[model samples]
Target: MIPGVSINEILTLTSILFFIGVYGFITRKNLISILISVELILNTSVINFVVINKYLYPELLQGMLYSIFIIAVAAAETALAVAIIINIYRRTGSVAVRETETMKH
Candidate 1:
């Protein structure tokens, strides 16, 4: 146990968040919503890394480093995704997934 929180409790919360992200990704039709879900999934992973590292190996900075790297990657991913989505919206006039099936000439 670390301070007031247990590993099991942290794992459970992360699991729930991960599932919620998955559900959002699967159910949402909008491109922005899908991006949001992806971010949520990434965030949950970061949380898991931090919690596990804190409890299992408090002396090493590996988890924190990995989490920082993940955050950087997530930032880049979101920037690229948003740019693409914006371009798609500009061309199609909507950000819904269904609207992307047809190719524009």
Candidate 2:
């Protein structure tokens, strides 16, 4: 939509963001960091959906609807995740992935 930007460029950007999110998710040992990584991953997908829909089917609202649904789900998931993390922190006193392993009991 910009003067020179193309869908390919947008998709490439999203792809890079996706991999960065994946890397963060894989290497992060803290619950908060993992949650942030997951959010980043979800955001990239949302962007992809919207961009593809806008470029290929500008007449339809399906992509926009789907993205709205995704955003709602992501919000709910984040709330639940934060609540769980807080509970775990209160119980174990640490949010580190390795340190919270005692929760199995």
Candidate 3:
């Protein structure tokens, strides 16, 4: 850990990772890849939230708590999404996202 590093560095790193994840989410055409990108983005924000709260507000871990909730929700979401994806792949020959959109309501 470099003592010379500033808070801005941490923020920048978090933002960069978030944007990369967003880009992945947008560009990926496979459901599995998109799900992975979502997780990446969620984790990026969690890292930012936890770091900000840890350094700026030590008494309250509200941000950390929110991150935990997000993790749980994301896990549940992934479970359902993967199951759906597997079903789709079994029925359809392709894992393309465009083919799965018809199932959406």
Candidate 2 residue pairs in backbone clash? none
lDDT of each: 0.95, 0.95, 0.86
Could you tell me every candidate's TM-score relative to the true structure?
A: 0.93, 0.94, 0.84
Worst 10-residue lDDT window for candidate 2 reads 96-105
lDDT of 2 by residue, 10-93 (tens): 999999999999999999999999999999999999999999898889998899899999999999999999999999999989
Which lDDT value does model 3 have at 86?
A: 89
Predicted model with the maximum TM-score: 2
Q: Which residue runs does candidate 3 get wrong by more than 4 Å?
A: 1-4, 98-105
Tens digit per residue, CA lDDT, model 3, 1-105: 237776689889989989999999999999889989999898888888787887788798798898899889989989998998888899987788898677556
**TM-score of candidate 3 relative to the true fold:** 0.84
Which digits, one per residue and each the tens of the lDDT, describe model 1 over residues 38-94? 999999999999998998898998998999999999999999999999998899999
Instruction: lDDT for model 3, please.
Output: 0.86
